[model samples]
Target chain A: MARHIYSCPLRWSDMDAFGHVNNVVFLRYLEEARIDFMFRLAPGDGSPSFSGGSVVARHEIDYVRPLVHRHAPVTVESWVTKIGAASLTIAYEIKDPDQVYVRASTVVVPYNLAEERPRRISAEEKLFLQEFLAEEPAAV
Target chain B: MARHIYSCPLRWSDMDAFGHVNNVVFLRYLEEARIDFMFRLAPGDGSPSFSGGSVVARHEIDYVRPLVHRHAPVTVESWVTKIGAASLTIAYEIKDPDQVYVRASTVVVPYNLAEERPRRISAEEKLFLQEFLAEEPAAV
Candidate 1:
């Protein structure tokens, strides 16, 4: 029931012509945070099933406030909102202490890359993810 | 009401390490199709208010099938899903003749870039957008 925190560094190219981080680039940040939480921090000794192969089935993101490029890193907090047999939903907030730039969620499905098919969540993997389980507001 | 169709070309870089288009890149395709429908094809011969300024408030996208990099362009169909006083929703599909790769929707709020706030839709803009009005399935 704890959240995963990632300090995501901002890239100069993340900004768009508007001089603010482009809405699409926010997904890249979420991808990075998710990779850290699932691949690096999972309980497995090495090569978690998630690292083997996974697919993004869906994404819902809301832009709260515009952000400009800065040298400092921003905080991305993530937690599991839902876990089904074949898919899981991870929710995230990209923010500072006082303000939030984005609220988002992704539905991810485990896949057997070699077999090219979706797979059920492994017990070991589920146990690792269960530690971060929490509910999020309804996804958009 | 007609759908705005864009022949969206794929870049080699659009594919991820998985050998399929990165899920996030699909948003860029939707952005392109929306820009064509609103900024280029809107009735106004001159720059439309959309070009002046607008913001993406929210996005919901679902992946239907994986698409590999191809020389031929894919088709992106877009239409207005909802238009409120201060916000509008656009629905899109990235597809070929027989298959759909993604389905998505975006809620956009017109903005006064200088004033830094949302603005109401104009009568002329509403009239033009009405021709493509469509209600999509629930956004995930």
Candidate 2:
């Protein structure tokens, strides 16, 4: 299971009144990481092709600790937790260099553009995601 | 109980590759509405003065529909849902002028800045919130 590490710089506007990165801002960071991971595996252009698109079904987030404003960049680690016939579960860990900040999991379903409904996962996508899942129970 | 309607312009960057406001972006919009609601009720100068503060505990969101890109403004309708001993639940409806976009609910826990933990709701604050919750739910 190889992990995909996506890094992003925190913008000034991302901070809230408490001087910590706003909780909602983490969702944007996570989306960027997920998009990057998908492009890495499939190697698509910037636009998301809809021939077979993906949509989020649900998201479960646990903010273990608040991320404070920092000079250094933050890393978002993501991987497929479970791949089903028509859906997949992706998990994320957001952290600075030393400490883990937030953890989240999202359920994504593959949609067939033609049918306008969810479709089964392709063998190719399953193979690609296989490289990222852990052998035992996945963490973070 | 009068409903406070807060309108926010959607930035071009708020849209994702799907040509709609990203799922995560909705959370930020909700936060803005929540903050604005708090400020309107309490009428405080913008500062980190949390001698009496609040934090979000749990959020249950429903993506009933999607809001597409448009030049028109998006309206966020927010109101108190329920007031508890130490927590307050707020409901939000994000919509365009004529149609519903999304529905969301959040639980916010009041905190004492001095104690640095959750605290019981004050009589004055509870009365204010009760008035807001007494109104009918938003259309969106």
Candidate 3:
């Protein structure tokens, strides 16, 4: 399965007083990458018109190394790990070609905002996600 | 053991497009509460001058319910779940008078900024932390 790669720009303010990217900011980067993967790319590939209208049920993140703000961008590699009947798990790595700064996973549940409740994954959405499905990540 | 209670003020910008407090913002609240627990209160107990010169090694956060913007502040209750030689775990709950919004835990490793290395829990620091230690939280 193929992984979605997002070239994430780093904001200078992302770094805290410690001169490194704050742990909470790393989750923002993951959200950006996940949005790019699920919202931007998925529907563009001739799948359903559904976007990333979902809720983050849970998140597990590991900060492998500290990241300092730099001019160049870091790459966030994301792929589907588990797709359940109503939810899906995505794993990601924010890294450079040489080193990984963070490894993380998020559980997402599709929601029907108009109805004010979560909805099950549709057949077409599952098929779209299947293309990027990798049950086991190499490292993350 | 006493749990650290922090009244976290919610910013209007903390909400995402969904009009609820974003999941990432919950982590920021946790950070605020942790700083209060580890930095503001720890050394002030007449223990050593060791503050929260620590790094977040890992975080596991579960969003139990959605919260919208409000004038009143939410409460973050933090407690020690495990204290190891080099690291400790902090479990927290972001709640209000009647409901819990999030349940999370973080593994933190104390670091020596000048020496640039992880350090073991000192005797004084351990004693200070022990006062707040509760191995098993009611439902973190």
Q: Could you give the interface RMSD of each candidate, to one decimal?
A: 0.4, 2.2, 0.4
Q: Chain B alone: TM-score in each candidate?
A: 0.93, 0.84, 0.92
lDDT of 3 by residue, B16-99 (tens): 998999999999999999888888888643333346368999999999999999999999998888999999999998999899
Candidate 2 per-residue lDDT, tens place, A97-139, comes to: 7877777777777766556667877777778888888642345
lDDT of 1 by residue, A85-111 (tens): 999999999999999999999999988
Pick by TM-score: 1 or 3, better one? 1
TM-scores of the models, in the given order? 0.95, 0.74, 0.94
| A-chain TM-score of every model | 0.94, 0.85, 0.92
- Which candidate do you rate higher for lDDT, 1 or 3? 1
lDDT per residue, candidate 2, B61-115, as tens digits?
Answer: 5565667778877899988878888888888888877777777777777666556
Report residue B117 deviation for candidate 3 (angstroms).
Answer: 1.0
List the candidate 2 regions with Cα displacement exceeding 4 Å.
A1-3, A42-53, A96-99, A111-119, A130-140, B1-4, B42-53, B57-60, B96-99, B111-119, B132-140
Candidate whose TM-score is highest: 1
How would you encode candidate 3's per-residue C-alpha lDDT over A1-140 as one tens digit per residue? 88999999999999999999999999999999988887887653333333636899999999999999999999999999999999999999999999999999999998877787889988878898999998766654
Instruction: Sort by DockQ, best first.
Output: 3, 1, 2
Which candidate wins on DockQ?
Answer: 3
